[model samples]
Target: MRVDDFDFELPPERIALRPASPRDAARMLVADTRGLRDRVVRELPEILRAGDCLVFNDTRVIPARLEGRRGDAAISATLHKREGPRRWRAFIRNARRLRDGDTIAFGGEVQAVAADRAADGSFALDFAGDEPVEILLERAGSMPLPPYIASRRPTDARDARDYQTMFAREAGAVAAPTAALHFTPELMAELDAAGIAHETLTLHVGAGTFLPVKAEDTDDHVMHAEWGRIDAATADRLNAVRRDGGRVIAVGTTSLRLIESAAGADDVIRPFEGDTDIFITPGYRFRGVDGLMTNFHLPRSTLFMLVSALMGLERMQAVYAHAIAGDYRFYSYGDASLLLPA
Candidate 1:
């Protein structure tokens, strides 16, 4: 389909610069077989069935954004994928100032040598140190805030905590699973008490998630691969949920994509490890997840396409129009939507 079909006009003020004061205070737009309902994150337990299972992405966001200099010219790089203990695949600004052998000195101890420029214009940067790269990033890197938010303001200490979910543990992601940001300990406790089970998996979200679909048609768009993992135990449990007639609710697109990647044609989920570049579009059949809880997405983005696939394109367009006119927030730090397509 033409990419233009997914396009819409969004008012600039609709973008959320800060998250809700209490995470669970964020609005949630619930669209199910019945119809669209405006709700809040705290009311999740009321909307979901007791047998539903919410799968969350526990990948922690790293301070991947870096500012450095090579012979007086400044360079900015956001590390997307970890190629080695010291090597990272990064998207660079002022990339024209760098060559394969060039070394950039990030003040106060972090330095990396640029090597291998990919056709997409990203670079492989190998840090110069014996210490773990995470520690080096601690000294020199800032939170990799989404450009939509960062362009409006600057990242600060508050964002360090705000951008991470309570379930955060394993670290690797350059981007936060925004939908999960609406979840809180209190909300989880309520869900647990309500007998709604939840699980965690990992998907190191990359810089590619922020990239726009420049392709004229959906067939021409290529998704960037992101590393993810699902253990045997999680797979078996998810399968059991389906067998017992429970809904498998994916907490975010990251979890949804990884689960779909590991699912069989018969709808059985299996263990998965490694990269997935699954580009979900309309007409694609979903095998693994029964429902999705995700943030409002950008116009013409792959994420919007994913939701459109779950719910019909016309339905999602109506959903968005309602969200906009109702004053619901948009983007990574925005409000969320619970989509259950029958």
Candidate 2:
């Protein structure tokens, strides 16, 4: 399908700048082959059945945005994907000012020298000094907020806690697994009481997730690789649930992607630990997830395409239009949707 096939009119006001207070208070739009239903995120437990396995991506968002100076010019760097220790692929402001071999000092203590420019204008950076990059980033980096949030303010103390999910454990993701953000401890306990099981898989969200689809046709787009891991224990648990005829509900697109990437064509999931660049567009066959709970995505984005693959383009468009007409929040820190394919 064409990239334009996924396009929709999203009002600027609809883009959520702040998350809903209490998180679970965010609105939810449930879509299935039957029709659409508007509900609150807190109503998820009642919507799902017992014996269902909810798979979550436990990837933690790193404070990866950093401000530094290349000589006298101020540069803002957002660590996209990690390449090696002290090395990263980053999106920088004023790329023309910096070139290969130019050292950019981060917070006047640690420095990273530009190595090269990737085709997409992202920079390959290698840090200076003996200190590990992780250590330096921990000290100097700030939360990498999405660009739609026009507030140029620094990530405050509240963002440190609010931008992440309750189950975030593993590090490396630049973006949060947003669908998991609505889940609170109370909700988890409720699900547990209802006999619903939850398992975790990690997919360090790459900056590529936010990148727009530049291709004219969806099929021409190549997804960016992100490291992910699903341990044997979680695999065993998921398999057990599947064997018992339980539905596997993915909490977010990241978890769904990772599971589908690791699953065979026959729909059996396996233990996997590696990088994946799996792109799911409309017409792609799904192998793993039976249902999805996820945040509303941007227009013409790969994530929207993935959801379209789950349902259909026409149906997704209708749902999105309904969301817009109903004044539902959009994007990260926005509302969510629970999708069950027919």
Candidate that would win on lDDT: 1
Worst 10 residues of 1 by lDDT: 107-116
lDDT value, residue 11 of candidate 2: 91
Look at candidate 1 and give me any clashing residue pairs.
Answer: none
Candidate 2, 149-186: lDDT as tens digits: 63634567788888899999988999999999998898
The candidate scoring highest on TM-score is 1
State model 1's lDDT. Answer: 0.95
Please write out the lDDT profile of model 1 over residues 176-244, one tens digit for every residue.
Answer: 999999998899999999989999999999999999999999999999999999999999999999898
Alpha carbon deviation, residue 227, candidate 2 (Å): 0.6
**Model 1 residue 28 CA deviation in Å:** 0.6
Task: Report the error of model 2 at residue 287, Å.
Answer: 0.5
| Model 1 ranges off by over 4 Å | none
lDDT of 2 at 139: 88
